[model samples]
Target: MSPLSLDLSPDLFPALTEAQADPDGPGAHRPALHFGDRSLTYGELAATASPLAARVAEAGRIAVWATPTLETAVAVVAALLAGVPAVPLNPKSGESELGHIVSDSAPTLALAAPGTQLPPALAALERLDIDTSAPTTSLPSPGAPDPESPALIVYTSGTTGPPKGAVIPRRAIATTLDALADAWQWTGDDVLVHGLPLFHVHGLILGILGPLRRGGSVRHLGRFETAGVARELSEGATMLFGVPTMYHRIAETLPDDPALAKALARARLLVSGSAALPVHDHERIAQATGRRVIERYGMTETLMNTSVRADGEPRAGTVGVPLPGVELRLTEEDGTTAVEAYDGETVGEIQVRGPNLFTEYLNRPEATAAAFTEDGWFRTGDMAVRDPDGYVRIVGRKATDLIKSGGYKIGAGEIENALLEHPGVREAAVTGEPDADLGERIVAWIVPADSQSPPTVDELADHVARRLAPHKRPRVVHHLDALPRNDMGKIMKRALTHD
Candidate 1:
């Protein structure tokens, strides 16, 4: 059986198309984007982007040098307008990684803002310098692209090997954004603010495209700052989107900065994703600002699966319920779906099937086929437990987060959260090292609140045993200045070792 074709709205980006068709509409004067001092109204965006899209549409595939700039946003908007698949390249990627992406994606052209220098990896492709203000062409109906056609080929982090491209279809984008609108009660009246990068799903799709799809406005901080976040929220930005790191910083500074707390309090919605906002930070922010930050669960392949809804309970340590159109379930290791009354203690791999899912892994048929179950559900490889109320709390990754010890399955997240509750512990990560007695021993990595007087292994171990179970306690402890983290604030557990 073939996958269902999206066939949602004829135009993938209905709001932008509406602006293009009627430049003089009532909301035409409203800002579509705000980056630093630069701005683009919905009407202006349509006019500027449609003409440039003519150049982009001609390419079989295009590579976008995704920078945190207005020009980058315009370039992507134009790609969608022209129905061309745009592959966003992270500027921070090393030469080898960039080379691998360019060679694998095989783009006919590369795009970036005028005067932006090009790296050697992008040199092979014909480069087009985008000048947003200078362009002219008759805009076509955005229904040009087939629903199944790839809109973006977003590459994975390639932690295990060379990066594989996830071919996101026009259908996935529309389905996801629409589902989010329903969950968030979002509308044209809302204004969003974020300072995330452009290459990833959290920043580009949810942060930027999500607003555009809803006819709402987005204000990008260009670079994240505590002051900028406060300023935007104080100036009537209704929603704030950020990763755990940004929220952590806000939590840290909220005591001394009443302005930041005030700003967060005024915002209608405060969202955190990309990584779990530590329970410690969550409690601190809620206590100081009276605003509980909501967390959403998503991936590069599946744009967004679940979220804590606006009207729902703002539950900490959970990713809330599945979106309106998404179907999510937990599966045991043997491919059996767990439908029993969930006690929120038993962990299983998350499997989902929905219109919001990506079409394929570009050029990797084997990997793509292996990623889905026999019944067509996507294997997320994320360990999570669903509460009876249906909120899903992710424990950790199946490959890294699950620790098998003395006949029990332990989730590193629960232990890390437990360690964070300790007054002397600032940050923590847990991993299982080989042990002759238990098969695997839990090892705890700690960034102590006071390095000069770090907590003893016995003290921290006893702390965990008391909070959770004794078997979950760390068998060994190592002190570090800081835990290794990725750009998104997810700790790199693979980097840690017993030695």
Candidate 2:
């Protein structure tokens, strides 16, 4: 990798050019992005974005119609270059959710691909058409914006109430990307491939910007297909980033497809994030192709906190140590006291103090204040256990996955992992149901491998009892055609019905 200034800059896009140029580096002449058959060279990207950036420079904050297209990529780049905070609107969002975001953020203008149709919520806003083929003039200099100035206003999933917009400052993006570059050994030479959505942190921030920050190139699969992944990796893409769902599909297809396995084996890195990758899927992929899918942990509020280092052991089920400049700790479930020791058995709520953290929850100062501790550590509300080695194993979320039953505190993640090991179980989710005897009994929601011969509740109970503790075993089992999962493949436990 070429020597580049790591200093926090007013604009991030220009930093890609400052890195030492290799003849074959991801630069002006090299292909920067590929979506379907369409491609954009670094030079083309800069030219396209420069004009758009100049136009939107005065817009306070703009809403981006984030579809998996070159226009969406260019729109975000333009916003960053102009030093404007961009609020990425998910194309899949319903009217109510979409309305909430637009009303909350109150962006001056909405940007989308030329000739694209927008829904009523966004149609109300002034629209700016992004034309990548349009002629460009000289690019404007990135004037000094405060390092703490908002760069992106990302909304939460709104599982509790209306989604809150996370105010992501320029510093957070720079810190997170740099820390990841250090951990992943990312460089201008690497070519990343993924088909994740543009609206989320996993896709837009890490999948796209991470490469650009490191002077590397990226190829968007347009949509994630196992075949597409195989094709890209086989054709010279160096890294693959995806969620657990994508990996699960790859694992299921590997036995019948040696070419796919071989293609994956050749990649420099395969990363899974947004949710935990089941131990079963992790082992299956490793057994098929001698490579372990590395897992990382982060959220919309924090760009990225921890990742399994490229040089470190690709340990299954653990999201490795905290990233550089991130100070992480686990606090008691009560949220008062901090855990002083790492025993790998005790579970606590993960709290972090880092530059990667968002500045605030936009227009919601009360919510923002409630999210942090008095001394300023963000209470992540994620339950995790830390090994003696400092590796973190996220058990689940504090509100849903941490079950207090009878006299013990249990994490549903371990039980869910154990259930996935059963040959008859294709997928599993565990939740604590109201119980008469114990305070709450464990309930296992299963999507069977074979519907005709689904594993019985007693059999699943016995399996979990044998693998984990008896107390952790499910008291009841429910079968489903498929688990309700988000775009990132995280099972939406709250969506499950129990009666």
Candidate 3:
């Protein structure tokens, strides 16, 4: 079959129409979404979203109360069908964060499930409660909006300051999904299962809309439990998508749970994203289930840049080649010269330019302009190295993960990976502290498997030195109960307080 092309136009909602038509088979009657005991067929999903789309079409922009339920999925779909920009609000966000988002995006209306109590931050907005049981209405044949038109105003995690909305255009979503189809060998016959939150791109965009675009089905676990994932996959779910945290739990359970291993072995695809899957977990899961989990690289600003191709080797510790139509390169820290050679030793910041990139930061033109170079490459601020064959291995983020020690540009990710391989270490994070001799010294923060008999700092340092190089070993160590992590399982290095 020819690769799916997304360059034709900007109407992403048409895929839903074709999905309902059951072009590939009896897709219209097939289950499109499943959350707990509730489910929706492709036909039902379209019917339920049409009337709401009509009502929402008049609004310039709308806020969606993003709960991990079928209603949240339907609300986002309705906004897309109406060609209105949807701003997803995290249900678990604090009052201050929610207030900041509301004031920043200035959404005219807020859409939530029927009977959902509005929070103080959203209570002031005009509210529209979605009733999924409402009868279907015929939508006016409004053609596709301009490809450049804003489809979403997704807010960033307010790690730096107040959250900034990233204006994701229709073209970016269409292109990224189509590119994934080409890379993953995705088709209408596939059924994807995940339990990720609906507020982020990984869950809301890729997990939900990806299946719909391919005329496939999705089953949401609602809450991530290994047994639930195994049950669904055993019952004919073709793929499983999750972050590192979920996979870590799965890895821990696989040794004692043969049934879970068997179910995983039956799956066609196992993907890990949002954060890097530690090599230790990768090896452990592969040993028990004989299935290698594929890793993909992406961010909120860039929907997806690269992924391990379904037909390609499932190499550990690498995120594979760039997706079709995505132009990727590595530039020096100065951001002027591009690193052309791929010796896989030198680490440089990743820069990309593609239709998959967000248009701009909403109401922050200066920040948006600063994100791109004069040549139009979006400065991703992620440090990575490429192999001779073009596979990109991300070292870490430029800000927190890069450590300059004794004139060597070291990446903390490798040290953390080496530390995880130690039997006594359950979790690990690495940072650089000011050092009088080496310019910066490597520090290891560890969660030990046995608190009473934790590995000594010298032993852990030697383990890293032997696994990698002596220079990469940690000079100082601190034991912690757990690493500070975000919802996606990515370690929040900025949250760590140094003594």
Candidate 4:
């Protein structure tokens, strides 16, 4: 089939017209989105959005700063139809990070929820107060989007340094949604529960676009609330997508929720990505919800490459096989072939080339060039291996998450994943510390499951000894209530490494 045949068309907002045609489409008045008490139907949603998109066109870039809601999704679609790039910033981000993003994007217009505080940078931009109460001008009719036109600019998680906006083309958005929907088996009958941040690709494309394209119902939750999530699932949802931390919280808080557990048993699918899922947490969520959590692999650079299936047994640590149309490989820094087979235990840097990959980093030509191999695969910067079944298991970040201790190279994720398996441990982070004799030694910072019964150093050491190789064990263990993480729930290893 031709590539365009798989495209996601902004011009076709069936949820908009379908609501008008039937006035009572599947999600018409059936709680399409809930942020606190505010609710909007499929019909009411399209009406509020069409005019706001026109106002967004007057500005060069539309910066959306609001708590996640169906309303936020409305604004995003309106901005795209209006033919301007949408820049969604994290409302909970520190002023410094927010300022950096606003300065980098230089939005022509800024929109925020009624009483939201704007950073100094966004405050300086022209503001268009959109009244959802009044009918505004409709978006100017347009032809097919310019294949190269920028639709969205998603910033990286900044694991390396400051985050840069990666320019995603209009075509790339459609490409990613098409690939994800097919791989994840999304259908019009599905009701997807969305909880990830709108600014990140893991949420933007996967949480929102992937479901919308399939004509599925998207139920938006403003943020992760263990109680609220259980309530939503009890109300009826077929699919759930979240990060590792979210699953951990749900597993911890809903041990006795039989109704919610039953709902999970009935749900068609469960998904986790954007970060690694510890084997214990994976098993806990599955056993609690009675459904396997399908873990996937992808990044902002390449929207999504692989996923474990809902029906398949989630191999403890693997991220699963590559999505259709995506080609993957492992290579050395010098660009030569590093590995040839899916050995289940080998490790190397992961790379991919596919229709779903992004066009470029906004203006960083050097960074863009450096991100790809000479053979044209986008370097994922992740160290991983494929199993005999072609399932991909992520080891750690190639540059920073790998620690050299004694004469062995160790994956920090390997230790962290094992540590999380202990019933007493709530969370864990492993980093290499300088050693006078061994050159480097493993140090673990753990968050205990119970504050009153935090494990002793000896207990933690014994736990690691049983789960890891002798050389991979931690020499020092420190207990902390919680580990530091960014907006996307990725453990801030850089901070631990430096501290």
Clashing pairs in 2: none
> What lDDT score belongs to each candidate, Candidate 1 first?
0.88, 0.87, 0.88, 0.74
Better of 2 and 3 by TM-score: 3
Off by over 4 Å in 4: 1-5, 8-36, 133-140, 333-335, 435-439, 449-462, 497-499
Kindly give the stretch of ten consecutive residues in candidate 4 with the minimal lDDT sum.
134-143
Candidate ordering by lDDT (highest first): 3, 1, 2, 4
- Put down candidate 2 lDDT per residue, 253-328, tens digits, no spaces: 9999999999999999999999999999999999988988999999999889999999898999999989888889
Name the regions of candidate 1 deviating beyond 4 angstroms: 1-7, 134-138, 141-143, 337-341
Q: Candidate 3: what lDDT?
A: 0.88
- Give per-residue lDDT, candidate 4, residue 460: 78
Model 4 alpha-carbon miss at residue 482, Å: 2.3
List model 3 lDDT by residue over 1-499, tens digit each.
Answer: 2354666475575556854445344655767889989988777787788778888888889999998899999999888888899999999899999998999898899999888988999988999998777354334424567888998888888777888899998889989999999999988889999999999899999999889877788999998999999999999999999999999999999989999999999999999998889999999999999999999998889999999999998998889999988999998988979899898878999999989999999999999999999999999989998999898988888999999988888888888889999999999999999999999999999999999999888999899889878888899889999999987788999988776
Q: Estimate each model's TM-score.
A: 0.97, 0.96, 0.97, 0.89
RMSD of each: 2.7, 2.6, 1.9, 3.2
Model 1 Cα lDDT, one tens digit per residue, 1-499: 1122334754766677777777778666778899999888888888888887877787988999999999889888889888889999999999999999999999999999999998999887999987767334336634487777889999999888999999998888988888777777878889999999999899999888989988889999999999999999999899999998898899889999999999999999999998787889999999998999999999999999999988899999899999877899888877665655488888888999999999889899999999998888999989888899999999899999899899887888889989999999989999998899999999999999999999999999999999889999998999999999987788999998755
- Displacement of residue 498 (Cα, Å) in model 3 is 2.3
Which residue pairs overlap in candidate 1's backbone? none
Worst 10 residues of 2 by lDDT: 15-24
